[model samples]
Target: MLISALLVLHVIVAIVIIVAVLLQQGQGANAGAAFGAGSSGTVFGARGAASFLSRLTAVLAAVFMLNSTALAWIAARDVGEPGSLLERIEPVPQLQEELVPEDEEDENERDEDELDLPPPDSH
Candidate 1:
């Protein structure tokens, strides 16, 4: 129960971290200033938005890492007895034997019954 709660928190923080990172502007965003197409200042004032977003992202990331480690530890220590794959499978039914032909058996008997006799004396 505790691990499950932590997992949920971890997922939520991860999503927030992603959103925070995406919301921040890239370094290249300032390039517009070189062509005078951008404002010399930001609405957040100097470095305001960047610093706040970066700090939030860092904190959430740390929490996410700690939660992941806790989950791994819990899983490893709480595992139950191992089971075999063969034990879960159902046994197959035995097949009936097919009948043999009578003629084949008779041929074997006849071969055994015949006795080897010497050829007639060559006069």
Candidate 2:
């Protein structure tokens, strides 16, 4: 449950990071301002939106990385717990069979009989 919540948060942060990066202006975008784009070009005056978005992207990236690490840690820690399909499956323990000399001879004969097979071309 905690992991699920964390995963959702991580996804949200990743999306926000994408949005934040997209919102920022490119390096050459400011070159136009030198030509005559005017001092009132941006709503933030100069570098307000870019600085804010870049900082936001950086913070969200850190959050995404931390959440990923947490999810991995939880999955590894709960590897043996009964939740997932692999975890729910309990391995069947092998039983020790006592063998006698007489039993061994009969078992060997049965094993040889089981191993007897026709060639693949016989099919």
Candidate 3:
């Protein structure tokens, strides 16, 4: 439950980061000259917008990292007990006849069967 919540939060943060980055101006965008093109003598100055965007991006990025770490920690946690599919339901005794014996003949038969197949004819 906690892990699921954390995953949802991480997804939300990712979306926020994407939206924030897209709304921000590019590196070469100038906000002073003509149609907000040049950055000669702007009121907000050079690093104002960059500083705000950087801080916002940093906060969201930190949240994303934290949620990722939390999810990983939850996934790596050990459960109460470990048991096989057969062992979980009932305690069945092993059947001696069902066991496969490792023999050289089995290997040779497999190889022969594989080699007998014909190769494909490409047009």
Deviating ranges (above 4 Å) for candidate 3: 31-45, 49-51, 79-123
TM-score of 3: 0.51
lDDT of 1 by residue, 57-101 (tens): 899899999989999999988866566778767899999898787
Task: Report clash pairs, candidate 3.
Answer: 33-38
Model 1 spans > 4 angstroms off = 35-50, 81-123
Model 1 residue 95 CA deviation in Å: 14
Give candidate 1's TM-score. Answer: 0.55
TM-score of each: 0.55, 0.52, 0.51
C-alpha lDDT values of all predictions: 0.78, 0.78, 0.74
For candidate 2, write residues 19-108 as lDDT tens digits.
Answer: 988988776667666666756465434655447778888888899999999999998998765476876677999999976767447544
* Predicted structure 2: lDDT: 0.78
How far is each candidate from the true structure, as Cα RMSD in Å?
7.9, 13.0, 17.2
Worst 10 residues of 3 by lDDT: 42-51
